[model samples]
Target: MQLDHVTLVTHDLEGTCRFFRDIVGLDDGPRPLFRVDGHWLYANGRPVIHLVDATGPARLSGGSSALVAPRIDHVAFRVAPGVEWRALVERLAAHRVPYQLTEVPASAEVQLFVALAPGVVVEFVTSLPVGAAA
Candidate 1:
């Protein structure tokens, strides 16, 4: 089966939404009426990122609170090289978001990492032509 959306539980709902929208270029879109406060971030007409407000008393299946200490290492997205990749890099710099880059050995792909929050890291992978610079 194909991959679906990624959900993030955060105390800072508006800040998280801003990061996804202003930095990652995702659009704040429609979300169904759920009891919890949250937002749906869309990319290319699809809701790719779901943000849930964790400031309230919601608990997970294990009875633990959301984002008390995030267990996820990072979330990655495949991006186009050239213009798209460059634009993302520019946005990160413009917003002063620190990031690190790593080139995949034996592959034309490069991965860029940025920590959006204490435990929320975002990675962008861009594939370039062989022999092309990142």
Candidate 2:
């Protein structure tokens, strides 16, 4: 089966929205009113990322350094080919967001890894070539 969207908890709603919309280049859409505190973003009619405001003030999942752990990972989105990945890297740099480019096997596709915040990491991947692993 194909993968669906992923939700993340964030304290800054507006900032998170801006980061995903402006920096990441995801189109912003109207967020439906949910009982809880949060917002949603979609790409091609599929909800890709959902942001939820953490309930109350508690210590972060595993403190600020937790993200550095070996098991930590981020969500990645594949973009169409012929798209400029470096321009995205430049956009991240212009926004002062730290990132790296990693190449995966077989198709030789590249992924732009961008850490939006202390515990939030997202990647923009080059679309897989024809006949590549799905």
Candidate 3:
């Protein structure tokens, strides 16, 4: 089976929305009528990131103000070839978000690594289409 989505808890829903939408170029997708303030970010017409507000309508999980980060080091999204990256880089610069482009060893593919906030690292692995991912 393939990957479905990655869920992240955020204290600032709007900020996280902007981080993924404005900075990462993902569009907002429809979310279920769950009793929580959250958003679904879609890429390749699929919901990829689910953002749950730490202080939303209901405490579906932990309700502390402490930033809840992903347990794993990072969540990676495979990017399609020919994706315009200059604008993304510029957006990162505009927001003062630090990032680096790292080439995957033994392959021509490159990975763009960026942290939206402390403990919120997201990686964009380039040169792979949705269905072509292994």
Candidate 4:
């Protein structure tokens, strides 16, 4: 059994899409019109991220980062090993998004990233041993 995707609750669908596209380098597909309110984004042909518009206002939190809770602290993506992770960081910096880099426990891999929103974090992990795709 593998992880399929994550549904994020947001008040701004277009803004979230822009965060993933411009900051995280994910492709932004066509805006999906729903009876409720939401949009879908695919990573490598799989719908890995879904943004559902919440029917309320934004609940401002006082946390420094959004990785404090367990309810989908963040969504992680895999990239090719040895890729220029710094370039991605620079791109995110140019966009003025705050992020932090860390290493996964028991592994020599580095995850790069930034905040998707005030309480939404995005993680880019590049340690899927060769020949692995999800």
Candidate 5:
């Protein structure tokens, strides 16, 4: 089955959106009328990342990203083979966002790691042919 979406529990909703928009190159997209604050980040006309504000009425209280450990270490997205991986890397560098790259074992995917927030890490992976890195 194809991956649908990755949801993040965040206290800084707007900052999270900016990170994905500016660094990840995702654009703001439509989201259903849920009784919460969040943003739908779209790529190729599909919502890939969903950010939900877990902040309480205080909005700055001990909640979500703040009051608990990050539930997920990272969320990964598959990039097409033709994507400009170099340019993407440069964009991240330009923003001073820390990231690392490594090859996936037994697969041709190259994984990129970036800490999106205090407790959030996001990954972008480029799919390669079998033995491509060999």
Candidate 6:
């Protein structure tokens, strides 16, 4: 099955949206009416990131504590090489977001990691053409 989307419960909803929009190149788009406040971030016309407002009085069912940070290591997105990859890296740098870059061993793929929030990190991966520099 293909991945649908990722949900983030955050007290800093606007800040998180800014990070996704300005840094990750996602657009803040339409979201259906729900009890709580939030935003849906879309990429390529698909809502890939869902943000939930943790500071709101409304609580989700199942008694899940939004204050407790998720244990996810990182969310990864495969990006196009060359211009797309370079532009993403440039945006991260321009925004002063700290990121680590590394290449896969014996492969043409490179990965960049950025800590998006407490206990939340995002990874961008791209495969470079043979003999092309990252």
Cα lDDT of model 4 by residue, 1-134, tens digit: 98887888887878987877676666656655777777777777767777888776444378445443335677777766655565666677798877777776676676776677766777887764544321
TM-score of 3: 0.72
Error of 3 at 127 (Å): 3.8
**Residue ranges of candidate 6 with Cα displaced over 4 Å:** 56-70, 130-132
**Candidate number that wins on lDDT, 2 or 5:** 5
Candidate number achieving the greatest lDDT relative to the actual structure: 1
Local distance difference test values of all predictions, in order:
0.89, 0.71, 0.78, 0.70, 0.81, 0.88
Question: Can you write out model 3's per-residue Cα lDDT over 79-129, one digit (the tens) per residue?
Answer: 656646556667888989888777776676778898766667899776644
State candidate 6's TM-score.
0.85
Winner of 1 and 3 under TM-score:
1
Arranged by lDDT, best first: 1, 6, 5, 3, 2, 4
Clashing residue pairs in candidate 1 are none
The true-versus-predicted C-alpha distance at residue 105 of model 3, in Å, is 2.4
What's the TM for model 1? 0.86
Cα-lDDT of candidate 3:
0.78
What is the Å distance of residue 6 in model 4 from its true position? 0.9
Best by TM-score: 1
What's the C-alpha lDDT at position 130 in model 3?
37
Off by over 4 Å in 1: 56-70
lDDT of 5 at 25: 87
Better of 5 and 6 by lDDT: 6
Per-residue lDDT, model 6, residue 59, is 43
Q: Which stretches of candidate 4 lie over 4 Å from their true place?
A: 30-33, 57-70, 127-134
Clashing pairs for model 6 are: none
Report the lDDT of model 3 for residue 85: 55
lDDT of 2 by residue, 94-134 (tens): 98877776667665687777777777788888865655532
